[model samples]
Target chain A: MAFMIAQRAYIKLYLINKVEQRRGYGYQMLEELKEEFKPFGYVPPQSEIYRALHELVQEGVLYRTKQLKGNDPSVDFQEIVLYHFTDNGAEKAALYKKQVKTDLDRCIGMLHKAVADNFV
Target chain B: MAFMIAQRAYIKLYLINKVEQRRGYGYQMLEELKEEFKPFGYVPPQSEIYRALHELVQEGVLYRTKQLKGNDPSVDFQEIVLYHFTDNGAEKAALYKKQVKTDLDRCIGMLHKAVADNFV
Candidate 1:
């Protein structure tokens, strides 16, 4: 199901871009994705999400920045890593979008042929 | 690409069913599929095709029969194994068709959302 894979990629990109206006921590994005996919009876594994994020970072589609969490100076603060799209990332995302569209159209055509051929 | 995987399955099933009126040898189906996907800049691998065929056979969706090739009885006849759908396979194919349709609808919806969100 290339479409499903493409859909997952699209959703992940969308969440990363739109989550808090193009910035979100990995766990936050994963949670959001889980919620989004809950209706479909599928919950993405955390490892898979993390792996995808790692890949995006590797591809320069995203950059990671670490920030200190909590405001108290006396307490040990947690480090939170947030992902943001690089300038090149946006262009790549656009290209990916176009590719996904092409793939979608192709799949639709194949499905139609399958149905018409009565061997679906 | 879940859609692509599903499409491959659909195509394989379709080819097996429609090729020469529902009976074709493995290599013949593979060649036909290669031709079908040629315009898309893809050629299904021999291993993948054979694997899919094996799986289908294991699933009882198809039964194989061995036939001798060539016209002369004295000639060393080449054995050709042709695959044909079983009674149960037609029913399974119908169910698979319905599932593919559902998956297609879901993918279309996701793609629309991805585009509408402008993250694609």
Candidate 2:
């Protein structure tokens, strides 16, 4: 099942945050991510990710930069790909962000209340 | 590669929204999603997503509920696997949300300014 319990759930959550509201977030990269130093902690598996990229490209949800490869001799290999949201997509992404944040806030609120109530 | 542009970017964005600052979002569902009726637009691939969930569990970032399947005759199928952010994780998730929101706001602001600049 492509949408197994864990993956499906994560994708739904990913969509909420990545695609649900942002105008052009259909299929693309994070707008601003500088946390590559702690790569493993912050990075997801790269192989499977490309598949999503391919689908997004086909769906017109995302566009990618011509691949750029650079060598930082002492460090591991580096390949930087730049993906940008279409104008229509970026606007939508922003709108979605608010809706998602609101939903997330509500959930956080409920969790807090549940904890306070000692309902653990 | 799992971390293809579309998938990698989305995962990074997903981590930002789902894990960066919020308390306990490591491997979980969107906090509150009642928009299931529009499954294709909002829903993601289930098979691939299961992988992320399984990994999160292995990393001790998430825990899952026993699977529960529902019967809604008209619907394709219904199965809900509830997930909860551990106490420690939820707090981190909340914190991450702020950082992400801030980063996003900055990007949005920049895009707005750039558009106004007519540099495109």
Candidate 3:
């Protein structure tokens, strides 16, 4: 995460944004992120994703509910833990999204003008 | 720059891109960046700009030309040093621009999908 802070920040925002939309299991979220970021050529490490999820839960931005995994009706099987955002988590996610949008728009717009005005 | 690595990287790419496109003066580039980034609500500091410019020169990515200022013929006038990319500088700038474009497009595209798929 430290080595790839920029990517990490965006992933964080995307993760929280997803949680706010609907409840999600940790493994599912990681799988979804892997698929979503495939086009970007990034598959975030499993450990890093888990670390981020754990941090969010610790920060009280997310809550987890444990239930039986999938459709398997085995009492011996381990339960699945799904995550949901608190109200504060949702608010924070919205803010992070907005900030990313702002900075992206700004950087892209400025780069366009700088290249055009300076180079041309 | 440490606090805003994403923004800094973009700015560095933009600056190099501009230098490769046309010869420019340090002060002029700073002014242009300020105006261009105004929409994004960032005014990159003059010192930071100078530092970046100097670093590029030190790295042999840019060269400086000292010319007497203005059309007014006066020996008392101070010389203005303008910057331009060297052959290597132009090549480096092109590479940097390409990398920035790749990451930017990736980041922006993933963000759009993440927001749309999750938030919608």
lDDT of 1 by residue, A4-89 (tens): 24534655555555533754786778788777756555566777678778777787778889877777756957888888888888
Model 1 chain A worst lDDT window (10 residues): A1-10
Write the number of the candidate with greater DockQ, choosing between 1 and 2.
1
Colliding pairs, model 3: none
The candidate 1 chain B region of ten consecutive residues with least summed lDDT is B1-10
Report the C-alpha lDDT of model 2 over B19-87, residue by residue, as the tens digit: 333423322434322132133233444443556556555555556664425455466364556555665
lDDT of 1 at A95: 73
Please write out the lDDT profile of model 3 over residues A2-46, one tens digit for every residue.
111255555666668667658477778888877766766777777
In candidate 3 chain B, what residue range of length 10 has the lowest lDDT sum?
B1-10
Chain B TM-score of every predicted model: 0.74, 0.47, 0.76
> Candidate 3 — which residues are off by over 4 angstroms?
A1-9, A20-23, A45-61, A67-79, A87-120, B1-9, B20-23, B45-48, B67-79
* Model 3 lDDT, full chain set: 0.66
CA shift at B115, candidate 1, in angstroms?
4.0
In model 2, which runs have C-alpha deviations exceeding 4 angstroms? A1-120, B1-59, B70-80
- The C-alpha interface RMSD of every prediction is 4.9, 13.1, 7.1
DockQ of each: 0.30, 0.05, 0.19
Clashing pairs in 1: A1-B1, A1-B2, A1-B3, A1-B5, A2-B1, A2-B2, A2-B3, A2-B4, A3-B3
Q: Say which candidate scores most in lDDT.
A: 3
Pitting candidate 1 against candidate 2, the one with the higher TM-score is 1
Q: What's the lDDT of the predicted structure labeled candidate 1?
A: 0.64
Residue B120 in candidate 2, Cα distance off native in Å: 11
